[model samples]
Target chain A: MNGHVYIIGLGPGDQNLLTLEVLSLLPTLTDIVGYGPYVERVEVPNTVRKHGTDNRQELDRAHHALTLAQQGHRVGVVSSGDAGVFAMASAVFEAIDQGDISLKTIQVTVLPGISAMFAAAARLGAPLGHDFCAISLSDNLKPWELILHRLKLAAQADFVIALYNAVSKARPWQLDTAFDLLRKELPTDIPVAFCRAISRKDEHIELTTLKNAKSSMGDMQTLVIIGSRYSRVIQPLSDCNPWFYTPRSITKK
Target chain B: MNGHVYIIGLGPGDQNLLTLEVLSLLPTLTDIVGYGPYVERVEVPNTVRKHGTDNRQELDRAHHALTLAQQGHRVGVVSSGDAGVFAMASAVFEAIDQGDISLKTIQVTVLPGISAMFAAAARLGAPLGHDFCAISLSDNLKPWELILHRLKLAAQADFVIALYNAVSKARPWQLDTAFDLLRKELPTDIPVAFCRAISRKDEHIELTTLKNAKSSMGDMQTLVIIGSRYSRVIQPLSDCNPWFYTPRSITKK
Candidate 1:
C-alpha cells in the first residue's frame, strides 16, 4: 500500500493567513502530526487523528508520521509559519536522509505559509524592504561563535537582519551577546524592532534604537528585526503607529 | 469623509496562496489597484473597480490607491508576494514620506502574505532550513556594485541565498555577474535552483550546481535559490522528484 504526507505551514496565529492549498487538504487528512501547539491550531474534521509531540522530538514525530503514511493513510505534518524554514519539512527529510525512515512507500508534498518575518514586516512597515538575512539565535543547533560571526558580517554588509529565536530559556544571554557583537559594526541609531504574537490579539510591536535594545524585550515568541544603516522610521501621525522602513535607493549605479 | 487603504500581498502567482485576510477584505474594497497581473488575480465583486497599471508605475499606482481612499473609497493595493518585501508597501510609504501624500488624510494597513522565497523553499525540501537571506538581483533600483558586494558577503556568512528578480530585460547580465562573484567564494558543487512560476499551472523547478548555473535558466518571474555550504540533495527512489534540503546543524559550539 502507498500513502502520502503533506507538510503544511499554518502561518502565524491567524487562521486567516492559512494558505488555501493547506486548508483544502485539512478535511481529507486521516492523521495530523506536529508540535502540540501547532497541531492544535489546525481545525480539522473529527475523522482525523491528531498526534502532538514535544518541541524537541522532531525526529521521532517525523518517523511516526512516515509510519502512519506507510500504512496507506494520508497525513498532515503541521508547523507554525512556513514548514521549510526551521520547521517540520526539513525534519522529515532529515529523517529520510539519516535512514530513520524510507521514502520508497510514501509520497510527500510541502506547502508554504506566511512566515513570521514577513508577517511582522507587514505590520512594522518594510524594514526588510531592502536586502536582508534571517538567522536563528539558538545555539542548540549551531555554535554561538558562528551566530556572532554571521551577525558581524551581516552588519558589515548592511543587510537588514531578522533574528529568530533571539532569546530562550536555555540561552538567556545569547541575545545580549548578539546585540553587543552587532554594536561593534553597526551604528547605535540603527532601528531594531521586537514584534510578538503578530496577527493575534496580543500582538505588540516595539521599535527602539540598537543603543536602547534590551534582552527582556523579546521572548521565545518574539521576532527581533534589526535594520541596516539605510533603515528609517516614520513617526506616527495622531493615531497611526510609527512605521519603520528601508527606502528603495542606492549610492551608485 | 474618512477612508482607508489596505496594502496587501497576493502571494506568488497562485490564487491558492492568497491569504484569507486579504481575500476577506476584497468584498469591502471599492477599488483595487496594482500591476495588471496582480490586479487581475483578485476576485472581487462587480461593485469593486479594478485599476491595472504598468509594472513600472508602482508609485503612481500607490498614489492612486491613496487618493481613491481619500475620496472615501476602501481601496486595496496588491503585490504578488508579501507587500513589505520589495513590493507596493514600501512604495506607498515612500510616497507618504516624500510629501507626495499626507498620512493624516487617509488610513493604511498592510496585511502580510506568503512570500515567493518561502513558497519555493517549501517545494525544494528545506534549502532555507537554517539561516538564510533574500536579495533582489535587479539593479534598476539599487547599484550593481552594491549587489556584488552583498552577494560576496552573504557567501562569506554561508546564508542560503534567495535571489529575487534574478533576470529582467533591463539587466540581463546581472544574474551572470552575480553567479561569477559568488563562485569565487562558494564551492563549485553548491546547489542552485531555478523555480519558475511556482504554484501556477506551468510551474517548473530545476536544480543544478553553482558551476553549472546559467543565466538562461531564469527570467524575471523565476526565483533562484543558492544553497549554503550546508545544503544537500536527497535523490529520489524510483521516479520521485529529487529533494533539496539543508540540515539544521552546525560545525562547532
Candidate 2:
C-alpha cells in the first residue's frame, strides 16, 4: 500500500480562487490536516477524517500528517494561501529535517495557490506590480528585532512590501512600531493598503499614507501592502473607485 | 451593450493551475487579448475573437484591450502568471494614468493566479517559506543601478530572493554580474535554484550553491531562487528526491 501525503495551499477564503487541481484532489483525500480554520476550508466526505489543530502548532500538525501517510493513509496537510509562503510546506520540511526516521518512506508534494498578497494586489490594482518582498510581522518563530531589521531594509530597498500576520489581539503594537520604523526609511506620503478578509464575503480595502495609517484598523485577517516610491493612486476616469499600481517601467534620471 | 474588461492571470502553463473563476469565465468571453504565447493558452471557440501581439508592446496591448472594452465587447486581457505581478494589471493602470478619456468608462478587473515564483517554489520544496523578495533582472524599464542597489540591500537583509527574467539571449550577462554582486553580501555556500518551464512539459529544476551557479543554465523561461542563510537542502531518508526549504521558524542570533 502506497501512502503519499500532499501539503497543499488552500488559497485565501474564496471558493472560486481554488485551483482545479486542488478541487480534484480534495475529494480523494483520506485525511485532511491543518490549522482549525484552514482544515474547515476543505470540504470532503464525512468518511474522510479531518484533523484540525490550533494555530502555532504547525510542526506538530506536520508530524501527524506524515504519520498518517506512513500508515498508508492519503493525507493532506493544508495551509492558507500558498503553502510555501510562510505556511505548512516549511513546517513539513522542518519536521523532516528534525530527524523523523519513520517519515523516510513518505512522499510529500506541495501545491501552490493564489497567495493573499497577490489576491489583494489584484483587487487593489497592482500595488506590487514592481519588485516586491513579503515579510510576516509575527515574531513567534523569529525575534522581533529581526523583523524590525528586515522591515527597515525592505523599505530602504524601495521594494513594495507585503506584511503578513501584521497584528493580532496579542500583538497589537507590532504593526504600529513597524510603521514608525518605516517612516525613518521611507516618505510619510507612501501609500499603505490594509486588506482584510480577502476574497471572503466581508472583503474590505482601506488605502492610506504612512502618516495617516492607524494600527487599529487591521485585525488578524488583514494583509498590509506598503507601496514603493513609484507607486501611485490613479484617478478613476469614471465613477469607479480609485485605481492604484506601481508602474513596471521607470526611467530614473 | 455593457462593456467590461477583465485583465486575467493564466497561471504558469498548466491547465490544472487555472482557477475556477477564470476557467468558468473563459467560455463567456467575447474576446481574448494578450501576448502571442499567452493568447495561445486560452482555448475558446472561434466565435470569440483572439488578438495575439508581440512582446514589449504592453502599453499598446493595454490600449487595445481597453478600446475593445469601450466598444461594448466583453474582453479578457490575459497575462502569464498573476496579472498583478510584473504583468498586465499595472500596464492597464498605467494606460488609465497616461490619459485615454474613452477608457474611463471601461471597467477593468484584475484577477489573481498562481505566480511562477510560487509554482516553482512549490515544486522545489518551499525555498520561499520565509521572508522573500522578487526582483526582475531585466533592465528594460528600470535602471541597472536601481536593480543592483535593491539586490545588494535584499542580500544584506537576508531575504530568499526570486529572480524573474533572470537571463535571455538579448541580455545574457546581467545574471552573471548579478551573481558576482550577490557574492559580496551572501556566503559562497548559499543555495540557489534554477527553475525552468515551470508546470510545463519541459519542466526542469537545477540546484547549485552560489559558487557553482552558472548564468548560462537559465533562459527566459527560468526563475532563479536564491536561498537565505537559514535555507537548506534536506537529505532524503529513503530513495525519494532531495527536498529543500527555508525553515519557517528562526531564532535570530
Candidate with the greatest TM-score versus the true structure = 2
Off by over 4 Å in 2: none
**What lDDT tens digits, residue by residue, belong to model 1 across residues A1-253?**
8688899989988998887888898999999999998898889888999999999898889889988988999999999888887888888988878863356447888989888898999889888888999999987888888988899889989999999888798888889888888888989999999999898889988899999998899888999999999898987454888889888776772
Docking level for model 2 = high
- Per-residue accuracy of model 2 over B1-253 as CA lDDT, tens digit each: 4488898999999999999989999889999999999998898888989999999999899988888888889999999999998898999889978865666667778889999999999988989999999999999999999999999999988999999989889889999999999998898898899999999999998999998898988988999999998999986666765777999888866
Candidate 1 clash pair list: none
lDDT of 2 by residue, A1-253 (tens): 5588898989888999999989999989899999998898888889889899999999999888888888889999999889999899999989978855667667888999999999999888989999999999999899999999899889889999999999789989989999999988888898899999899999999999988887888888999999988899976666776777999998979
Q: Lowest-scoring 10 consecutive residues by lDDT in candidate 1 chain B?
A: B97-106
Candidate 2 backbone collisions, by pair = none
| Model 2: reference contacts kept, as a fraction | 0.90
Error of 2 at A227 (Å): 0.4
